[model samples]
Target chain A: MSSRDAILARIRAAVADAPEPPPVTRDYRTAHVDDDHAAVVDLLAENLADYRARVHRCTEAELPALLARLLTDHGSRSVAVPPGLPTAWLAAAEGAEQHLDDPEQPLTARQLDAIDSVVTGCRIAIAETGTLVLDAGPGQGRRALTLVPDHHVCVVGSADQVVASLPQAVPLLDATRPLTWISGPSATSDIELDRVEGVHGPRTLEVVLVG
Target chain B: MSGTYLGMPAFPQAAKAATRDTRLRANLRHATHTIRDKRARAVGELDDWAVLREAGKRIKDRTLRHLDTYLLQLEEHVTAAGGTVHWAADAAEANRIVADLVQATGETEVVKVKSMATQEIGLNEALAAEGITAYETDLAELIVQLGDDLPSHILVPAIHRNRGEIRDIFAEKMARWGRPAPEGLTDRPADLAEAARLHLREKFLRAKVGVSGANFMIAETGTLVVVESEGNGRMCLTLPETLISVVGIEKVLPTWQDLEVFLQLLPRSSTAERMNPYTTMWTGTSEGDGPRDFHLVLLDNGRTDTLADEVGRQVLRCIRCSACLNVCPVYERAGGHAYGSPYPGPIGAVLTPQLRGTTSAVDASLPFASSLCGACYEVCPVAIDIPEVLVHLREQVAGQPGHRAERAAMQAATWLFEHPAALAAAERAASATRALHPRRLPLGPAKAWTETRDLPQLPAESFRSWWQHHHTEPPTPPEPTS
Candidate 1:
């Protein structure tokens, strides 16, 4: 048997006496389905904001201008762009130096230390949890794009990408893939229970809830 | 014992001993009941709790399915965000990677936030082997470290030790580890905490390297998230010049939006709070703030193996909130040490066996430790259905070829049932021979089962004959027609 087949056989043997697990399916319809995918995205954005994540909404037509404005607002001179980020998003930003370079390729440790902020697209946005998931696809680029930069500006699409519940989300995953789930910016507390922010990931997490 | 449950016998033996400890039973009963009650009230406050729970479970399932893609994406995002990503296949690989990271920093000592991933890898021991000292900053972790004990509970590692035991551990061992407990340390909670703070404070400030584990890692932004009640994690995350995090691959979620679900689920499920006191987030490196160098070690010890099993994969859905531990009757009485791993309680029962592979005597015995009561299912915020997994693991154990004797026993019973005439004859003979039957089986597999439970009293008449004699009246067909 192939490794996968062997694994499956072992699972069968393990659960031989167990009632079988429910079969995977994506057939359940939402009781109150969003009018369209955009409504789902909107709900996701609203819930994200409710969880204290800073949310920004922009149209594809106005994307570049909004991207520039958000960067300028953060007072950033250099921005790390994921390899797969839309070209138009960077087109409007005139003054800032665009960095699509992988830190591993040309940049040394010191060189990467100079860059500020990273912007990319997410794989899925869970509305129920106010979470943004990135599968690091082409437009999403490498994991470093999200980590090395202090400010993370991620784009979320409004249609065909959102799932109402987690049961609706499971069958969509593939185990071998690299998955990252972020609820909010990285944080930790002390012995006295004092709150502190920005330890390792990003101090400020800015989400652009765009269609 | 070298550590918590270090010398304890395999699961069945330890559980048997724990079942008889009246004082231990009282403590576990009181503690678990209180925490479980508080957790329920905390969970009930949320209007969309069921929806949130479903969402959390779904997001985890989806991510695990496409884990390779998400993990690659996470690495890409972290690199893009200006962070270095290292992949470690197992505990040895993870320890080597972390030790190398610390050695690269040229730091002899490292401060740590409470991280189970690190513990699972035995990172501290590994670091010490490299002659690099690791200071545990979390209060409970400090106690465990000073005493050279293994952690039993995920949230409270020292749950097995009462206040008096803590005071003794501190007064006796703290000085050897670092600073001594104040001249006269008392069993008072405040005094113990104060002593720990003084001891850890020096290490936190002097250390050039820090180590941690993230509750969740965002793939989109390459952001690693750590949530804790204590602020020590923040100091370790920031104060050190080099920060290294050893994170399980399963902790990865796809986006920040997905992260929000757990931020809500974790706080209430863990400490029964509307919000955790501290939440630390960082991406890559910041020149002027926190660690200028950041490295994320993605540790995949037994997670991939765990993920491969369809029934067992659900264990990955755990967010490490440890709500199941608070409600488990077995966990409360047996204590975390008896389970013999970092993760104890209901989660430990299913998780440890799968991670370690149910090949060892201890691993094989873990699944049977539970009562098969569904309390864990009801209390689990992520809805892991632990009882179902326990039964599943049990089947796995029983299916092994070594259980041929058991198989033969079952087969004999099956054959007797199939032949009712034989079964009835046997039953009648057994009923007549009841006085001759042994009260308990001789020393062997059935000895434990028969110790407390009594053999059923045989009936004077077999059911077949009793039913045959009692059913003399015929059906009233005329009444039915009317």
Candidate 2:
């Protein structure tokens, strides 16, 4: 038999003796038992801050202005923009130079080091554990856009996108795609278990809690 | 078996030395207990934990079942997105693929994130053999590399060493690597971090190639994800002109939407935090943003073989959250090195055997390392039945054709029990000859058991015979005679 066939045969034998697996219930209640989306976003924002991610709150109208100002505050000169990023967001940064880069761009170390910030939309936000996920999609650029920049300003819509628990979020995802889950700025406490920020990914992450 | 954990002794012999080290045991116990307790509390905060766990398990299982289809879809998506995917059947193939990719760029050095998959494949060692230097940017990884020590835990590779050991390692070894520690580097956490930051920053700035392993791969979108507490992963991913990610095939999930579940489960289970500090992800590649060139080396190694076993395939469901490791009593005592692989603890016990095959002494002995305790099960975010797998592997060992003598002995015992009359006669004869019995079995297969335990002395007479002699007379007749 072919190797693949042989593998399948062995798997069959190994699992053949197993008691049949319990039936899977794909039917899940996803109506989100949580009462308020804004409340959940608030909790998530609060938790993100706890992990040292700079958190900002703004209305939809103020989002672009807030993002531009935040980028300026970080002294960002060239901001990486995902192709699907809200044009309005960049339009607000009228004076800030923009580098519309895709995730797969090949750039030199110094080149990436020069880029100041990246802006993207989030896939989902978990309130129970203040975390945000970016599936490289519209608005969210290639995963690198989030990683290469010193600062990341992610905008999360306060709506049904908020999930109270992972169980509620599982069925919503397909396993075969690339998924990036962000909880806070990349940091490690490896040196004497001393927490240090920005060894590889973004050193400073800013989340826009847009209501 | 190549350069990765080949010629490693059986788990028992390796654990023997580790268990004897009282200080090591103390450190391991303290670290494991603290992490495990904190993890328990963290998990306890979520009411829907069981549901989440079940979902995680099912999602992984389903994805594994249709892995080929998903992989094809992922490849299509990635290629369309301007990324290249390479399939590697084993470590040799993976190393060759990655080395060739790096060579194509005419680069001799590369930055690396903390990746277990890369370690499992012995990528750095392979690259070193190819005359390319790979810099470990993760702080713990740096310490492990500088000290020439094996990682002892999943989350904390250097948990066996304390602050002073780290300072000593940095003071002595930093210069040889490239950057030296600042003069009079103290054991203070801040000073140590600064030293590492200064040391790794140089590599990050100079390296033209980056290597990493993904936490997850989305098949639908052809995206690879790396979730780490350290930002070094991001640096290796983005700063380098070329990024090569060596990912295990089992890391694949179906779609981007599926990332949400794992994001919640991984952090709390691993670092005992509500969320991970950093998560880096990328598809094939994009122009004008990050690394313009991206290579995803999809590594199978022994995963497909492992996946064939239904009882063992559950290992693939593991998110590498390492909750099981933190709670493992065996791991707490013996530490990670005793497992003799990149993967350790309860997961390692079952997984290594399946992935590596139960052929070597280390692989064969791993099944017996565990106490069959189920604490790993309780704390596992995905609920892998580790003890059950260990026992199953033990049975597999006992049932192997090489154990002919043992099988025969068990068969003989079975036959004796099946023939009760013979069994009774044999028992009576043994009882009658009990005084002739030796304290220990001499020159026999049973000697090993007899050496540790004494045989019970026989009764003065067979109980059955005594009952027959004394109780045969009727009570009324006895009373009349009196």
Candidate 3:
């Protein structure tokens, strides 16, 4: 027999004496907190901040100005925006050049690395773990969009995009889509067990929660 | 399982020297205490911790009970999702498969994410033998690679290293690898991380083949998840053209939804964080994102044999969180190197002997390395009874040869206890020679054990004699409550 067959035979023999295991029990809570969007978003903000992601709040109408101020303050000369992002979001930031990614002719990793920052919207925001999920949706371009750049400004558009926990988020996510779960800027605790933020991924993570 | 731990001495001898190295003990103590306190706080935040831990244990148990079925399902799903699947019965086969894959791509180098499965198989050394150099991308892994060292801890592979030592490694060796460290790299963690970023970026951007191991593989969807703190995992998972993941077959989960329990348990248990900085999930190859060519190597290096033993199979439930290591007193003092395997601490003690078999002297000694303290089980998210497994493996080891002296001693005692006359005579002879008894045994199988404490003083008379003199029938039974 091939190694595959031999191994399967071994596994079968291993558990032959044992009875069938019972169906798994999932008595754990689906959501640690009540289903209040505002409260969940608050928790997300706290958690993102806890991991050293700079948290910013802005209204939908004021998003353009806020984006401009953030980019200008960081002294960013160029920003990479994913394909299909709202053009109006970067309307106020005319001083900085925009490298709009065309899905047909996508920017290379080398080019993405040269850009100063990236701005995109997320598929879901997990409140419990303070995670932002990107699925290469219309606003989120691809895996490389948020990864190569030094900074990321993720916009959690509304409460509909917020979930209380991973259990609530997992069902809605499509497994076929490439998923990137960002909790904070890149960080490492490898050096003597002391956590220092900003390694290879975006050093500065600015999550703009727009209500 | 790797050349790194080849021909290692048994646990007693290895730990004997390790305990004397005060610097190693101090490093292990500091790193373990920091993570232990943080893990407690992180776990304390969840009100349903016990239920969550139980759910994790049950899911793993259910998956293991039907492992053959789940593994077949996983292969079918992966193949359907534009991914190729391969099977290896052992480490040497797995390495040959990977080396052939890398050579097929016509690449001389491959970047890697930190993985225990790969370490167990000794992938880098195998690849080097094939004229391929694999670069380790994680910060701790990079430190280990640069220092020409073996991984000491699971999550923090270079926990034995301090910043000063790392600074020196980078300063001395960075140029030899690729980019030299910047002038005057200090001992600050931020600076060290920055130096590593600069050094590894060139390799990550240019690599054509990437190797990894997944924390969880969802059988239903064929999606594999890599949980990590640094973005090295992201770069390796995304940047390369061809991605090969060598995962142990036991890593499979029955469904996509099963991830909820582990996703909640793993982060807090491993790094004591609510969530690690990056978690990348992909189902096979994507049309325009990540790697275009993906291969999944399902490795069964001793996992099948481990599952055969009823008492020893709970070890497959481990998620490689390293929480058991942080809480183990033996691990904290003796350090990870003494375990003589990629896996260290409580998990290693139970796991190495099963995976490698206890025929070797070092492997046989692993079952006795523990003090039977149950801290590892208490902090274990999946609720594996590590101490119970240790004792069970100890029984198996004692039953083997080379323990004839201990077996003979036990047999003599059993015979003496069965014969009342012989026992009485023995006790009287012991009382008669009380003055000649040494405080500590000079030499014997128990010399090591007896050297730590004094033997009890033999009484002039036996307990039976005292009872006879005091006219003690059995003591009167206490009155029962009405």
Top DockQ prediction, candidate number: 3
Q: In candidate 3, how many Å is residue A189 off?
A: 1.6
* Candidate 1 lDDT tens digits, B54-89: 777778777776676677788888887668888776
Candidate 2 lDDT, B1-482, residue by residue in tens: 23356687877667767777888888777667667767778777776768777877778777777667677777788888888888887788899999999999999999998888888888999999999998888788888888888776677788887778889999999999998999999997657766887788778887789999888888877778787776677668866789898888778888676666676678789888876776666677654546779888888788877777767788888877778887787787778888989888899998888888887878877887788879888878778888888888888877765555546777889998899787778778988788788998786546643453467787877676677789897666444554
User: How good is model 2 by TM-score?
Assistant: 0.77
User: Which of 1 and 2 is the better model by lDDT?
Assistant: 2
**Tens digit of lDDT per residue, candidate 2, span A88-198?**
877778656888764455344556567888888988877766778776678886655677577888888566677766556556654333456777876775542345565
Taking all chains together, the TM-score of candidate 3 against the true structure is 0.93
Q: Please report the TM-score between candidate 1 and the true structure.
A: 0.67
Docking class of 1: incorrect
Task: Report the C-alpha lDDT of model 3 over A128-191, residue by residue, as the tens digit.
Answer: 9999999999989889889999989999988789999988999999988899999999999897
TM-score of each: 0.67, 0.77, 0.93
Give model 2's DockQ, 2 decimals.
Answer: 0.28
Lowest lDDT block of 10, candidate 2 chain B: B444-453
Per-residue CA lDDT of model 3 for B1-482, tens digit only, reads 13387888877677777787888888888889999999999999899999999999999999999999999999998999999999999999999999999999999999999999999999999999999999999999998898888898999999988888899999999999999999999999999999999999989889999999999999999999999988999999999999999999999999999988999999999999999999999999998888989999999999998999899999999999999999998888788888989999999999999999999988888988888879999999999999999999988987999866557777899999899899989998999999999988887756643454479999989997777888757778899999
